[model samples]
Target chain A: MGPITGEQIAEKLSLTRATLRPDLAILTMSGLLEARPRVGYFHSGKFPHQIVAKKIQSLLVADIKSVPIVVSEKCSVYDAVVTMFIEDVGTLFVVKEGGLLEGVISRKDLLKTTLGGQDIQKLPVGVVMTRMPNVLFTHTEESVWSAAWKLITHEVDALPVVRKVAQPDGSDGYEVVGRLSKTNITRLFVELGEGN
Target chain B: MGPITGEQIAEKLSLTRATLRPDLAILTMSGLLEARPRVGYFHSGKFPHQIVAKKIQSLLVADIKSVPIVVSEKCSVYDAVVTMFIEDVGTLFVVKEGGLLEGVISRKDLLKTTLGGQDIQKLPVGVVMTRMPNVLFTHTEESVWSAAWKLITHEVDALPVVRKVAQPDGSDGYEVVGRLSKTNITRLFVELGEGN
Candidate 1:
């Protein structure tokens, strides 16, 4: 029921109080139950899964983000593809001078362009990239869980990790600092599973 | 210390046993310490991270795999890319008669093939696909952790979830049943963080 004494539980289960003490200790310690010196045990209303969730939510994107591969907005699609191959990343951040993010390009975008029969060697990535305002991004302090949520909700493979900077014109711009990708999330998943 | 009674521990800390019981309950319950009647408490040599690892490692590929997108090996590279877009999947499983896995193809492969300037409409996917025995796969019973490990180690975006079936010719062939991808892992990570 609401709260039961150790003796009552022992009697109900036909076991000695000594035999039940360890189990009660474990339940209380895990936050599944609350134990009091004189009072009985009360359910703590906490689940074991919450412990895992709490642990995961505490991790920041800054701790796990990978080095972002960048290309110039004026870079040819062919050269962008070459950069992608050289860096072995699925998505690339298109940046201007000072590493300010301009747009984002993905393998899917390049594939579609190639299928268009366009002259990829001459086509600037700016023509095909997802532009700055449309780009989804994360900050260094954002929780990895929220970043992973963005990746799932936006249905994008990666997000450029950015820092806000004032441009010469006094406009706010994002400077690419890192990258958060499904690959990074998967790697983190594996690392967590390995208890590292 | 090796082993000590709660009374002894409380005495050493200059706290009453009554004040120490809850702390002791939590430590013993979380398995940082082992409690025994008469004998007292001993270190359990368990870390909290191991709990998270054990929870993750217990998840299976079958529990989280997604429906696989498939195509005939004779399917054109152009058609394969179309199927990939239509199905909204980054990877495709190439299968032959009886739904046996023949090969695997990814957006990266299609992108590379598209960049080659070859006639994609006439180029069969089999020519560019990663052939069987070279394709990395996972079974239903394999741990998600191990499968995620495979994804990282092999540097593939997705894996065919398969079952070994006895062919009519007495050859053992893998029948593609599902797909496991970085997206799935990311989704799982998000779900875990949500405490679901």
Candidate 2:
């Protein structure tokens, strides 16, 4: 009646009991789920439907308040911190000659860059910036899952939700705007399933 | 003032403006984003982040639920449907005996198993299932972003969030509950940025 047991799992998977145990052990150690003695496995069921949705949105960078404090393609770490704070964000979407989303600079990236014993005053954010090749981005309209996918694969917290739009000067197209880490999906899930 | 001009993006992304045109066209057509030919690019500021999250979550099944339903793994398709509905989920977490997580089954898997000349009453969900060695999962307590990443990188929709814990016999641990699709993350973000 409860969750299927490990024994049940083995039968269902068509694998010998011995092989699957180790795999299960690794999972158990991570706290993703837990098992009871004889009763069977029980899901925490913490993250409900709504919370998952919220976490996905928080990672978006579009419509975020602008921080004009960032003066250059390479700004001071001091100024980067200021920009993030003023914008009430943890990361910054770095741009170049046009409004295209060039790269990203997070408080962590800036701090990590500075911690490397680099000259703070002379260093441009570009030096510490996660360049285009190194960055993970989503279109301004990618599904939350798509964005989440980029974050997880890139091992970063935010994604530049860029948009490729036609040019006014009779040029071609370009990217603009970005999405950053806006919410913790797990936390939101946990909260939604709180009362249930 | 509006989205960064295409010229800016070309310089920053290091790509020719022509090459990027298709991606822009596709994004706009897909309704994931919007654009202004002369002004700039813009998202609807109304994409249902939660629904999008749900759609993505639907893709993260590490196991196939349809197998059991099709094969009548000791039950009826009606029962399987009930299980799916009760869990408020569309996929079933497949497992092996001894509490190890196996492949997962989604509605698509079920339907596929019963497709064409296949008979639902006699088929096992496993037959049409996306099987092991290709299944993706998440660790217990992994970050939402990281978990979402696994779903994305692997092109999946859900993860069986597993963990290890005392097995009542005071032994070691085992795999347990699934985190599945995290819908809450998207929901929260959309609500917080309603009509943005």
Give the top-scoring candidate (DockQ).
1
Predictions' DockQ, in order: 0.35, 0.03
Q: Name the best candidate (by lDDT).
A: 1
Runs of candidate 1 exceeding 4 Å displacement: A1-45, B1-44
Residue by residue across A109-163, what tens digits does model 2's lDDT show? Answer: 6544543545666777777777776667666455555555555445565566666
Clashes of each: 0, 75
lDDT for each residue of candidate 1 in A1-196, tens digit (9 for 90 to 100): 3677888677765669998677677566545578877779876655557667877899999999999999998899999998998899999999999999999999999988888888999999999999979999999999999999999999999999999999889999999999999999999999999986
Q: What is the TM-score of each predicted model, taking all chains together?
A: 0.81, 0.33
Candidate 1 TM-score, true structure as reference:
0.81
- Model 2 lDDT tens row, B1-196: 1364556555554668897566555444433336777765544332334334433444323331112212233443334444655554545665555555555666434433322334444555555555655666665445554565555456444556666656667864446455555343443334433322
What TM-score does candidate 2 get on C-alpha atoms? 0.33
**Candidate 1 chain A: worst-modelled 10 consecutive residues by lDDT:** A23-32
lDDT of 1 by residue, B16-132 (tens): 899768767756654557898999998665555766787789899999999999999999999999999899999999999989999999999999899888899999999999998
Best by TM-score: 1
